[model samples]
Target: MDVRLFKQVRAACNASTEKVADGLVGTIVEIGGDPLTVRKAKDRLSAVLQKARNGVPQLVGGPKKGEEMAVVISVRDLAELVVAARQQETLGEALDAIGFKPYRGAHILVGQSRKRERLKRSGDAPSAATAN
Candidate 1:
């Protein structure tokens, strides 16, 4: 497995501990196996992650005055999720927790983070307001 990916797993493990006390919920997972499993998991993980990214949204029409905007979970968030489901139970449980669409193997199809897009006004943004 790539070193960076391993680091990500470690980070996920840490976050999981914070989120649920137990490092990883469910049965104790192995998180390790033959090179093929690691490779496949990583590949599937990447594809699933890419499909979750948001490209600036509809720039053509610009954002609606007050419409909700789509937001993709960060790579790190996905990593945390994947690590929580490691080698024991299937990733389905983790994916389901996060609202990912059903997928084969350890892969999951995640949705955007999505939230209301507040209108921006001159000198009225939160950052500006906080500068008091």
Candidate 2:
């Protein structure tokens, strides 16, 4: 809600942090009414924010059907969160397609043939030579 917080969200967006995209720090403001669902309220609120065309935090989720639940999140923060969510989904799909079942620490696959040549000269494996 503060200017500083918005800046932080922008920075996270640049870094592509997923936590922000998942509405981790956003607050949900509930609106009570008759014959109106939470999802509808949320949608209406989102529309209003978008029309305003300002840098204020915006609504993420819609009002729930037959209920009242609206979520308000910083636009910048939401962007970062969305980026994180999408990246995870993409990575998962790629791994599944390749039948990859990782069972240990992350495997950092770096292409360093030139470096490997240098390491061979120094009588060391690529990893150890890079350490030097």
Measured by TM-score, the strongest candidate is 2
What TM-score against the true fold does each predicted structure earn? Answer: 0.16, 0.25
What candidate 2 gets wrong by more than 4 Å, as runs, is 13-16, 22-38, 41-47, 62-132
- lDDT of all predictions, in order shown? 0.40, 0.45
Clashing pairs in 1: 71-113, 71-114
- In the range 1-132, model 2's lDDT, one tens digit per residue, is 344443444345334455554432342121111222445645586554553244344343334554423444456646754554344335666586467987888887998565443325544546765778
Candidate 1: residue 20 lDDT (0-100): 38
Clashing pairs in 2: 20-81, 21-81, 21-82, 38-63, 38-64, 39-62, 39-63, 39-64
lDDT of 1 by residue, 76-121 (tens): 6456556644633447655655678754687676999879888889
